[model samples]
Target chain A: MKLLELRGLAASVDEKQILNGIDLTVNAGEVHAIMGPNGSGKSTLSNILGGRDGYTVTEGEIELMGAPVNGMSVEERALTGLFLGFQHPIEIPGVTNMEFLKVAIDSHRISLGEEEMNTRDFMVQVRDISKRLELSTEFLKRFVNVGFSGGEKKRNEILQLMLLQPRLAFLDETDSGLDVDALQVVARGINEFRSDENGVVLVTHYQRLLNYVNVDFVHIMINGTIVKSGDAQLAHEVETHGYTGLGEA
Target chain B: MAVPQPANTLQGDLLKRVLAHEVQETPWLDRSASKSLLNCNGFPFPWKGRWQYSDFRALVEDALSLEGAHNALQSSHDVDVRRFDQPETEAQTMEFGSSDGVGDFPLIDINGVLFRSGTKLSSIAKTGSVKVNDANGSVDRHLMSIEQDAGMTVEETFKTGNRVVLCHVRDNAKLEYELTMPHGEGIGYHCLVVWLAKGSTFELHLASKGAQVRRNDVIVNVLGENATATLSGGWFVDGSDHLDSQVYMNHRVGGSHSEQSFHGVVDDRARSVFSGFIHIDRNASATEAHLTNRNIALSTQARAHAQPELEIYTDDVICSHGATTGHLDDDSLFLLRSRGIGEESARAMLTKGFLRQVVHSEGGTSLLNL
Candidate 1:
């Protein structure tokens, strides 16, 4: 089944056009890498898809699980199994990481008419996932993303992805600012969560992350629209020839 | 000195009633201080530098009207658990000076006069100290609990009946004081005066919920060198409740330190006023003092007034004060919502966490539950 489909998606910030005529689709079990240059509206597309405010969709249609999601609120979209991993995770002081995760998971469960996770079981699940992500149990006691290193913030995002287990995830430049070791750890987390029941849209500039997390399709975005779509080899071609080389294609 | 009548009729009537109460005999009473306090018209209003952001006229009137009624001075005794006094020694009978005219509020003066008039007082003494060394080479000192015999636990509700508390932490002693105010009707006032001797340490934890009018005035005098004091509290206000608190940390000698952290959450048409003043005397060289007041307004009609002031005369001292009032962070809200948390739940969690940060501990947990 098609997990997410965006047709002729055009959005603008403050009356300035950003994403122009963006059309993309992701089927279940597919991993699509979106490579773009600076100001190419890559982040804009991710934000609009997540239903963030301040971005006006001039002309577009966004569907999740074959249902229209253009009018849904951010939380509503999230409750429907759509997640957006921010490039720069915000630091929320005073809210413990564990408390935030519990609320997020419980909210989703309650919306789906499922019972809330008990403390013992919730802690067990969190411990298992945290260990896999190389996170200390002490990290759960601290405020969400507060005072965390750049690499820690990226790992925290992947941690949420694993716990929330959204059917469709948009990772916008999640590999930025991560060292090779941290990148490998984050990639392993992503690989562990990927399956036939869900899909991922990897929005990044480098092919390094693609190497770790297999990508079925590569789309080169320039000037707010996808200019080229090809197999995984296209990512290496862009890496070798640069974005300007693709502009002439 | 003859008592002066306040020009304001309502205030004058209230002062007369207060002065008419029989003066209780006590060896610690300072007649001169009481006489001088009676001569003042009334507590200062917002025009006064110290009371710039708080007004007590309405609260005073409401309290005075209940003075002689049946429900007047309803002694719930719940809040009385927080009252801790030291055995009176010759050293504790020092002259009671008038308000320093800068940091002291009129409510404190009223409390002083009433205290001299023999209000109910309690005493709790420390037998021995428990000191534990930390990994950082610092020592954790534990003093006697206020409720030593009753098991160290706080009561859920603080029925704010009019009362006066006199606390003394002697040399080389340490003490922790906790107080929680519950929701109630009518106006309530509580006054606490603490004296710290040389080498003494004092920590205070205060928490209050919504009420018609609840006011707490705390005065701490670091009388000797090497004395330290830490004050932290949280207040939650909803509906039309009004919560006003004032803290005065007086560093009278050199080498003294003091710190204060207070947080408040105002909802609906509720309002809160927090005024913290740290006064470093001219001779209090090498003294260090810091104060921070943080507040969040949950509704458009809710209001919060925070004034953190520092008065330092010694050039060798370090003192700083800061106050901030605003709604919850938008980025924080977005972050929570993006994680699938509902908007209302997200707001509630953030507000609770904000207050919890100020009063985070076993003692604080009880207060939050209230």
Candidate 2:
């Protein structure tokens, strides 16, 4: 069974079409890069897969691990190993990051009939992952995302990506608003999360992220659907020549 | 659940009955309250921002139900307590619900007030606990004073009652007072009025939850230069509960600082009303003050009203006020739910975070069953 698949997916928000008959398939161990111009429905597609509200799926079928993703709640999808890293992680004051991630991980384990993690072992694991992501363990004690810089927010999202270890990770513009150094850190975290048992669909705007995290397929999205699909060379071409003629072709 | 009390109209005679039946010759019970009490004129109709969303007529009548006063807060041996008339306090002058445009709340007469004798509070800093052991009463009044250059920490608790604590922090003194209002089905009206003299510091942390009717008021007057006051509170209400929290900060002197922040969570058919008013007197130059009140409604039927007001009459003053009344941020909730947390648990976590923004465990936990 494929990890994630979108068939004839069309979506709209506020009575306006955003995704017009888009089709994509993500198999295990495969990384797909979905690059799009502004208002090209790349975010709409990611949001639709993540079950975010305010988006009306006019016509589409989302399948995760061969099971129809329709009618599944947001948390249900997450428990089923579907994680979408938001571009902008919100600030939740008064909730420690450690507590938030622990609860999330505990929920995932309970759904899989696994016991809760040992607190001591969990802390060790958190420290190790945070160190690898170049984040201070002190951040785990602070409130989630409060007073966090743009780069810090992006790195925190990557931290979640490594902790949850879901089957399919759909990241939405996670590299935007990040410096070169912070971008490399984020890319490294994403690269570490890649494995033969999982799939990743990176929704991005620039090829800089692709330089660090190689993708098997690069799909250039214009209007509402993928206008062009090729190997990593497609992203480099779009960067040099732009989508001026690519969309028309 | 409908309030067990009938939808009785607030009669004019109610004020006269309170004064005639229970009148103490104290500054807190001064006749100044009579005008505001009668001005209510039978609680204005819905709209015009007067007693619209939540009504206190039930709590008023409930507080005045019994004849004579339930016992004043009995102080244990560790704490010193006295009557309002015991200390020579400045008489009369304190007014309520005037010139703030906050809401036309009725002013109930002060029944019985307890004042801690100021003779013991000395220049040295000390820690003291004031327990309202039997404070469950129709009305309870407490007056305290921290002497010049003195410092003390006070913690008070009450089950179900109306309490008014008027404190005087002399010049160069510091006081930290934490108030805990427990969960009860009865009614309560609690008010804490403080006067901070020159260079004095005052902090009041309060946690209130679950009552048929619970009213809280924190009024502070920065009367001296360099005086500072920080007031914070958290309230949780659900299942037909009603919480009314009002804050008033008067910066009358220059070089003073004050911040007022409160957060509350409303669920089910419960209701919460929060109004914060910061007044910077013309002479209050170089004063800095901020007021914030945040409320979150968990249910569609739940209601939250936040009104933060500022009246700055002086320049070179950093003064601002903000109030927001709405549901928890959808993005925050989605962030949690997208991480595999169940919807119900994620919402509860967000709701707790919303309230904990201002209220901390160091103060106390009084969220009914939170």
Candidate 3:
């Protein structure tokens, strides 16, 4: 069954249309890479999928696990097993990373009718995740992304994805500012999030990321709509010749 | 949470003024307090001036009444001493309004510091005199002694009324005390005085809620060549309770250092006021002083007012003061909520963090038990 299904999903902000008619679907356990030029509505699609504010869904429907998610809020969508790693995550001052994580974990735990983790157990779990992400313990004490570098924030977002274990993850430009080493680490983290019950949609402007991580399907987005779709080799083809070769596909 | 008791409702200034007199037997102290009462005539209703933003007058007029001031005096002197944080068994203590000797701490006097509390209304008559003004351009001062290691806690419930007064802490002595006004009655005061010796220190921790509390604390540190003093407090008021703390600190001698910090969180219709002033003398060279006042307004009706002033007479002295009053940051709140924390829980977390800054600085971590 499709983990997320979007049909004719048109969106607008302040009377300006960002996304036209768009149709997409991802079944469980599939990795999809979306490549598009800047302002080609790549981030807009991710935000709309995440139910972020300031966007009016003028038309179409988005279903997550068979439930319509078009009217849900960003937080509501998060609780519904949908996670989006932003291109530029917001920096929150005075909020420690650990405190933020505990609240998120406990929230999901309560909804699942499970016992909430105490401070000691929560710290242990956070440490384990941090170790896996190569995140230092001191980073957990600082404010969330307050003074973090671009790569550090991207890694932190993946760290959150690993902890939340969302059913569907939307990574928006996660490799924009990463070096080769950081890109490999981020891909490794994503590989960890890949499970039979979950799916990932990596939104990027270039094909450099596909070098480190494998992509099952490569969809080229133009004018807010997926204009072409092909297997993994398509990414390599698009990398060399750009979208010029897929003309009128 | 609700207040445990009902508020008192007495009318006019005369009735409340007379009630203050009858509660204390110290005729001298009675006379000293009455002079300040004259200023109450033109006292700006908490809503009448720049201070008019919060409806403090309505709170005083509606939520306050003539409570048993004498009962408050009785409780102050009789609180169980063993329950105190730092108990002193041997110290020269003077008996005044504090019946239980709440500030009785050991080694304070031997350290060349004197602390006194629970002095009777009569004992203040023999001490020296102090002249100070209330908010309404009225000057009121009193005479009191330096009772070493004598202290008390004022645990009064104000149903509809409050008690206002002036205090004097003499030089070269130390005093540490706690003022806990939880619920029921409201306590209002015009001015408080602290006359520090050349090398004395004073520490005070105040926590109260469920009433309208307004107190003015004035400290005049007579720091002899190498003297120091520290002042710190935390005010956590919730429900319909209102608490105000006004402080004035003066560094009169050179080579003296002073630090003051107070934090408040006002919830519901509760209001907290923090007005502070720091003065550095001309000859007080190499003097270091810092003052900070922070408040969090939790509800729309919840109010906070802060005015931090710094007066430096010597160019070499380092003195700084900052004041901030606002609700918790929405971004911080959103960050917590995104993690699944409810709005209420997020507010509590921030409030606790705000208060923890002061508690940690006060050198007494065990007091919070958190």
Candidate 4:
């Protein structure tokens, strides 16, 4: 079954149309990349899928596991296993990273009618994931993303992605500000979490991240809609020729 | 022109009620000093510059009625009074006006009168001081623990009426004092005075939860050289409750450091007032003092008033103060909500984080449970 299906998904920000009839689908075990020029509504697509506020769905339908998700709140979409990694992660001073992760995980668990993870097991799981992501234990003690470097913030997003283990993930420009080493770590985290039962969507402007994570399909989005769909070579073509060179693709 | 004394009757009524209590003459509670203070600085009114945002006339009147006064004072085991030296059952008569321009405050005057003639005093067993000497000679890194007066319970209910706490930390000693006030109704006037000796460190944490009306006045005097004092308070006012906190830090000698951090949350129609003053006297050069007060109003009707003031007399001292009042950060709320946490839970978490700074700074998380 398809993990996510967007049928004529149309959305706008502040009464301005951004996503004009965007149709996409991601099946289990598949990875999809959406490359777009600036203001192509890439982030808007991810935010609308994740049910962020202020993004009005003027017309369209969003489905998760073949079930419609209309009018679902941000947290409701998240509890249903949809995660949107922010392009610019917010800094919440005073909310420690550990506390945030615990709450998020518990919220998902409670929504699924499962017992909350005990502290011992939760700490063990976090330790394993932090070690894999090269995040220091001390980082978990600090405020969430407060004073973190650009690369650190992106890695923190991937860290949440790995822990939440959503069925479908929308990484909105997660590779924007990461260094080579941090990018490799983030890609490794994504690869480790990717499985036959889950789907991944990578939204980016460049093909650098594609070098680390292979994709089954690459969609070119221009002016609020996907203009072209191709295999991995399309991403390399855009990187080599730039978006301006691919006219009316 | 004569000052309009609209609260004269209220003051007269309060004085009458205070005099009705059994009188005990002690040097610390000098009736003459109290009367003089009252004469010079009458009851606090909104017209007063410092009290412009806070009016205590109504609270004082409610307290004077004596309705439910006994029930309010009954559940008082939660009030912990910790002292390093032998508990002084016989109150030591200390000069009130020793600090320049401090003893003239209206709250201090009322506290003086209430302490002298009204209310009985109790003493708990003494506890030894916790001392930490820095082998590395670093003034910034010091060891301290919240010390409980030996016989008092860890939790204490706030009793209405007047209460006074006097603490003196010996030279080179480090002490952490924590006071937790549980949920209750009625009015309370509490005064806490602390004296730090040379090279000593004093950390104070006060947390008040759901008090109908509470007024806390804390005065810390850094008398010795190289002494440091930190005062942190968190107040959660809800319903129709009101909380007013006044903190005064006096840097008497050079090389002393002091800081005050206060965080308050006002919900429903509740109101919170915070006034912090740091006075750096002359010859107190090299003194570093800072005060910050931040408050969050949760409801449309909730109100918070903060005044962080600094009076520096010396040129070679560093002193600054800041006060801010606003609702919760929308970005923070969205961040939490995006992580699968519901809106209400996310709000509660943010609010807890707001107050966690004060509690965690002084290692007083136990107060959160209360």
Candidate 3 C-alpha lDDT tens digits along A117-203 = 798988887888888888898989987787998888998999888888888888999999998888988999998889889999999
Give the per-residue lDDT of model 1 (tens digit) for A1-249: 999999999999888999889889999999999998999999999878878788889998989999998678889989989989999999887789999999899999999999999989999999999999999988899999988999999999999999999999899999999999999999999999899999999999999999899999999999999999998999999889889967646
DockQ of each: 0.76, 0.73, 0.23, 0.65
On TM-score, the leading prediction is 2
lDDT of 2: 0.76
**Candidate 3, superposed: residue stretches over 4 Å from native:** A13-17, A35-46, A87-99, A117-124, A136-155, A175-183, A204-209, A219-249, B1-24, B27-185, B188-210, B213-238, B249-265, B276-298, B306-330, B340-370
Error of 2 at B248 (Å): 2.0
Q: Write the per-residue lDDT of candidate 3 for residues B269-329, one digit (tens) a residue.
A: 8877777878888888898889888888888998887888888888888888998988887
Worst lDDT window (10 residues) for model 1 chain B? B133-142
Deviation in Å, model 4, residue A105 alpha carbon: 2.3
Clashing pairs in model 4? B78-B155, B78-B156, B78-B157, B79-B156, B82-B149
lDDT of 4: 0.73
Q: Give the best candidate by DockQ.
A: 1
The clash count of every prediction, one per candidate, is 1, 2, 40, 5
Q: Report the C-alpha displacement of residue A217, candidate 1, in angstroms.
A: 1.6
Evaluate all candidate structures by whole-model CA lDDT and list the values in order. Answer: 0.74, 0.76, 0.61, 0.73
- Indicate the DockQ of the complex predicted as candidate 3: 0.23
lDDT by residue for model 4 over B231-331, one digit each (tens)? 88788889998788889899989999998888888999998889898888897999999999999999999999888888889899888899999999887
Fnat of the models, one by one?
A: 0.73, 0.84, 0.20, 0.66
Question: Over the stretch B202-281, how does candidate 1's per-residue lDDT look in tens digits?
Answer: 78787788668777778898988888888888988999998878898989998988989999999999989898878888
